[model samples]
Target: MPHLTIVANIKANADKVDLVKSELLKLIDPTVAEPGCVQYDLHQDNDDPAHFLFYENWESRELWQMHSNSNHVKALAAATEDAIEELSIYEMTKVH
Candidate 1:
């Protein structure tokens, strides 16, 4: 299976960013155990606290689709709406 990479960038108001980070961390275990998930990790930029990224590896595109519609992700969206100033998601495959 091919690897998947998700780049999630966000800008939040003050501590709201931390709140979003906390919520995102809550998703780690469930995300890792999902059907096609091979690995899942979340990272924060040291120089820019407002920047965050979620690195995920999936068995296939199908599994990613399932993850997008899952209840856990939905809950995360709900929890983060108030905290997010801007959010962008990039889905791509590794070139090397």
Candidate 2:
């Protein structure tokens, strides 16, 4: 099966950046342990502390979907509902 590359872009409300970061951090360890998760990395924009991104690689889309529906992700979504200014997820495939 082909792998997937996921890029999640998140923007937190200026005053809520810390809260958003905390909630997102909660997903790291668990997500990395999920089956088929090749990589899961988080990054904060230096020029804009409120902007954050996740660079992830999954062994398959099915596993990625499972991860998306996991409880930890649900909790993060709920926790940041009000604190997030913008959220977007992109799924990609690399070409040789």
Candidate 3:
């Protein structure tokens, strides 16, 4: 089966950009160390600092789901509650 790819975009409230960024940064190391994580990368939009994106690849959708439900992910939700403006997630399979 093809690997699962996730594209997550996070938009933070103007006043909370730094806070949201810090919380998002906390996910990298832990996520990269997870069982099925193939790649996990985070990026910030140079033109819009409040916008952040995560590009991730997992061995399978099930493993990615497990990672989403992990304690660290929950913590991120809690820590950034009310600080985010919008969140979008896309799950995909590589075509090539």
Q: What lDDT is reached at residue 51 by model 1?
A: 77
Please give the lDDT score at residue 23 for candidate 2. 94
What TM-score against the true fold does each predicted structure earn? 0.88, 0.96, 0.98
Look at candidate 2 and give me any clashing residue pairs. none
Q: Arrange candidates by TM-score, descending.
A: 3, 2, 1
For model 2, residues 1-96, the per-residue Cα lDDT tens digits are 567999999999999999999999999999999999999999999999999999999999999999999999999988888999999999999776
* Candidate RMSDs in order: 1.4, 0.8, 0.5
**lDDT order of candidates, top first:** 3, 2, 1
Model 3, 1-96: lDDT tens digits are 899999999999999999999999999999999999999999999999999999999999999999999999999999999999999999998998
Runs in model 3 with CA error above 4 Å? none
Mark the regions of model 1 whose C-alpha exceeds 4 Å error after superposition. Answer: none
Q: Rate the local accuracy (lDDT) of all candidates.
A: 0.82, 0.96, 0.97
* Model 2 CA deviation exceeding 4 Å by range: none
